[model samples]
Target: MLRFLDAGESHGRGLCAVLEGLPANFPVNIENINKELERRQKGYGRGGRMKIEKDSVEIISGLSEGKTTGAPMTLLIQNRDYENWRLKSQEETFVSIPRPGHADLTGEYKYATGNLRNSIERSSARETAIRTAVGAVCKEVLKELGVTIRSKVQTLYGLNDTFCDLFDDGLYDLIEKSPMRVLRHQEEFMALVDSAKKNGDSLGGWVYASCEGVMKGLGSFMHYDRRLDGILSGALMSIQGVKQVSIGNPFYIATGAMYHDGITYEDGKIVRTSNHAGGIEGGISNGEQLEVYCYMKPIPSLLLKLPSIDLKTRKNSDSRYERSDVTAVVPLSIVVEHVLAFELLKEILNTFSRDNKEELLAAIEVRKIRIGEIYEKTTDY
Candidate 1:
C-alpha cells in the first residue's frame, strides 16, 4: 500500500514529506506538483501568508531522469515566512491563550505544556501544503491511468437549497476559473467572505469532490477496514477543519426507494439508473463516478478572537489574533480534490499490486475486462 509521513512546523524551516510504495518507472513531474501547491494557495479570503509564500515542491530523492526508481521519495516545501518568524525571540512567540475550536488546549494537555505554540504549529493548515504536493504526485500516477478528479465549493456560510448540480461535469471549467470555486452565486459567496473579514470573523462551507474512470472492485466488502467509503471518509476527515464527510448523497432520513440507486440493463451491461450511491456499493467501486461532500468548520484563528482563559493567569481573555483566512472553502476545494487523488491511487495500487507502471496499467485493463464479463453475466439473468 502507498503511504507517506509529513513533518514540519507552520512557521518553521519548511515542510517535508516522505512518500513510499510507488511503482518504478512512473513519470513524476515537479512542475505538476508545484501547480497543485499554487492552487492550494489561491482564493479570495486567503491571508497575508499566501502573499509571502510562493509554494513549490523540491524533490530531494527517489527520481532519476524524471521517473521513479521504486524507492521512497522525499519532498520539501520551504516556508518563506519562517525567515521573519525566526527573528522573533522564543518568549515573544509564546502562546498562553488557546483558541476555542482549535486543538490548542487539548494539545497542551496532551503534551503537558503551558505553551500552545508547539500545538498550533503542527496543527496549522500549512501542513496540508506538503500533503497536497504528495497527492499531486499521486495525481500524476492517476492521470496516466485516465482517472480525473475535480472539486468545487457547493455552499458557503451554510447556505443550502441552491440550484447547483454537484454531479455535472460541465461545471468543472467554470469552477476551475472561479476564485470561489462555485458553479454560481459567486458574488454572493464573495460578499459573505468580505463581510466576515470586515467583522473579524470566519465562515464555513461545504465542498464537493468527484472522481471518474475508477474501475470496479478497488476495495473489499469482506473486511471492515477495507471498505472504500469508510477509508475515503476517514482520510477526508483527517484534513484540518473538516468536520463531517458524506460519501454519495447522505440520506440518513430517507427511504430506500428515495436514496438507493436502481439498476438497469444497458447494451449487455448492468448500469445504475442513478448514482445516488456515488459510484460505490457493497464497499466497492460500481464503475460510476465517486462523489464526496465535506463540511469544513470556520477556521478557529479568528481576527475577532473568541473568549478563552489564560493558561498561566487563569483569567478570562479573548483569543489571540493570528493571520488567517476569512473563509477557505475555495482553496479547500482544491485540497479535497488532490487528497482524494492520493487515497484513490493508494487503493488502486493496493488492488493491482504491480511494481512497474506498464504492468500496473495492464493489470487495470485486465480488471476492466473482467468487470465487463461479470456485468454481462449478471445482465443475462
Candidate 2:
C-alpha cells in the first residue's frame, strides 16, 4: 500500500515527508518538484511570507541517478523563514487566542494543553508544501504513463465567469505569468482583492481541476470504499479551508433533464454526449477526462479582529493577529490539485497492479485492449 507521512511545525526549520510503496525504475526530477513548490507559493492575495521564502525540495533517500529504487522516498524542504523565530527562548512562551475555522483547536483541547502553539503549528498550511513536493513526484510518475493533471481558479468570491469565450485570450498564459496565478479577469479580480484588503477582510473562491489519459476501471463499483469519487473527495476535503467539493456542475438549472450527460453509442463505441458526470460513473473512470472542483471558505484570520479569550489568562480579549493571507483560496487551489494527484496516482497503481514501472505499463496496455474488445462485443439491450 502507498502511504506518506509529513513532519514539521509552522515556524520550524523546515518540513519533511516520507513516501513509500512506489515501484522501482520510475524517473524522478528534482527541478520539477521545486517548480511545483514555486507554483504553490505564487498567487494574488498572498501574505508577506511568500516574498521571504523560496521553497525547494532536497531528496534525502530512495532515489539515485534520477530514478526510484523501490524504497521509501524521503524529502526535505528547508524553511528560510525559521531564522525569524529562532531568537526566542523556550521559556518565552506565547499563547494563541484566535482559532481558525478549520484548525486543530479542538484537538488541543482534547490534549488539555495550554500551549495551542503545537496544535496550530502542525495544522498550518506549511504542511501542504511537502504535500505539493510529493505530488510533484507523483506527477512525474503519471507523466511517464501519459496522464497529466492541471488546475485553474474558476471563481473569486461571488464573481464568476463560465463562458469560455469571455475569458482572457491569454488567461492561461497570465496564470503562468502572474504572481497570483489567476487566469484572465485579472484586473477585476485584483480590484476585488484590493477592496477586501481595504476592508480588513478576506475572501474565498472556487477551483477547477482535470485529469487526462487516466484509464477506465481504476476503481470498483462493488465496494463503497473502492469508489474513486469518494477517494478524490476525501483527499480534497483534507485541505484546510476547503468546505465543499463537486465532480461537475453543482448548480441547478431551470430544466431537470438538462443536468445529466446523455449516453450515446457510435461505431461500436460507448460514449457520453456530454461529461456532466465528470468522466466517472458507478465509481469508475469512463474513458473520459476527469473533472473536479473545490470550494474554499475565506481564511478565518481576519485583520479586523474578533473577540476571543486569551488562552493563558482565560479572560475576554481580542484575537491575536498572525501573518496570514487575505485570501488563501489561490494557493489552496494548488494544494487541492496536489492532493488529488496523489490519490489518483495511487488509484492508477492499484489498477495496474504492478510494482515495477515497465510491468505496470504492460498491464495498462493489455487493459486498454480488453476495454476495446468489450466495447466492440457489447450491444444495447
Candidate 3:
C-alpha cells in the first residue's frame, strides 16, 4: 500500500514528507510538483503570506535520474516565511487568544501547551503544501495508467453558481488556469469575495472531483476498512476546515425514484445511464466517471476578531487577528483533487504490481479486459 508521513511546523524551517510504496522506474517530476504548489498558492482573497512564499520541492531520497529508486521518497517544501518569523522575539511567537473555528484552543488543551502557536503551527493548513506536492507525484503515476483526475470549485461563501462539470477532461487545463477554478461566473464570485474581505469576514463553499478512464474493482468489499468509499471519504474529511464529504448524489439529492443509477446497454457495451453511484458500487470502481463532493468552512483568521478568552490573562477578549484569505475555496479545489488522487493511487497499487512503466500499463490493460468479460456477463452476452 502507498503510505506517507508529513512533518515540520507551519511557519517553521520547511515541510517534509516521506512517501513509500511506489514501484521503481516511475518518473518523478519536480517541475510538476512546483506547478501544483503554484496553483495551491493562487486564488482571490489570499493573505500576504502567499506573496512571500514560493513553494518548491527538494527530493532528498528514493529517486535517481528522474525515476523512483524503489524506495521511500523524501520531499521538502521550505517555508520562506520561517526566515522572517525567526527574527521575531519569543513573545511574538505566542498567540494568547484562540480564534473561533480553529483548532488553536482545543489543540492547546490536548497538548497542554502554554502558547497556542505550538498547536497552530502544525494544525495550520500549511501542512497541505507538502501533501499537495506528494499528490503531484501520485498523479503522475495515475496519469500514466490512463486515469485522468480533476476538480472544480462549485460555490463561494454561498454565492450560488452553476457547478463545474468534470466529465470532460478536455476542459481540465482551462479550469487549472482559471482564477476561480469554475466554469462560469468567475467575475461575480470574485466580486463577492471582494465584498466579504471589505467586511472582514471569510467565505466557504463546495468543490467536487471527477475521474475518467478508471477501471472497475480497485478497492475490496471483504472488510470494512477495505471499502474504497470509506477510505476516500476519510482522506477528504481530514483536510483542514472541510466540513462534509459525499460521493455522487448526496443524501439530500437521494430519493427512491431519482437516486439510483440504472444499468443499460449501449452499442454492444454495458453502461450506466446515470452516475448516481459515483463510479463505485460495492466498494469498487464501476467503469463510470468517478465523482465526489466536499464542503469547506470559512477560513477562521478574519481581519476582525471573534470573541474568545485570552489564555495569558485568563480574561475574556477578542481573538487575535491573523493574516488570511477572505476565501480559499479556489485553491482548495486543487488540493482536493490531489488528495483524492493519492487515494486512487493506493487502490490501484493494491490491484497491480508495477515494478516498471510497462508493467503498470500491461496490468491496467489486463484488468480492463477482465472487466469487459464481467460487463458481457451482465449484458447476457
For all predictions, the C-alpha RMSD in Å is 1.8, 2.4, 1.9
For residues 324-352, write the lDDT of model 2, one tens digit per residue.
89898778868877897789889988877
lDDT of 3: 0.85
Alpha-carbon lDDT, every model: 0.87, 0.82, 0.85
Using lDDT as the measure, which candidate wins?
1
Error of 3 at 295 (Å): 0.6
Q: Indicate the TM-score of model 3.
A: 0.95
Pull out the clashing pairs in model 3.
none
Point out where model 3 deviates above 4 Å. Answer: 167-173, 251-254, 376-381
lDDT digits (tens) for residues 132-156 of candidate 1: 9999999988989999888888788
> How high is the lDDT of residue 380 in model 1?
65
TM-score: which candidate is best? 1
- The candidate, 2 or 3, that scores higher on lDDT is 3
Stronger candidate by TM-score (1 vs 2): 1
Candidate 2 — which pairs collide? 43-179, 43-180, 44-180
Give per-residue lDDT, candidate 2, residue 59.
Answer: 97
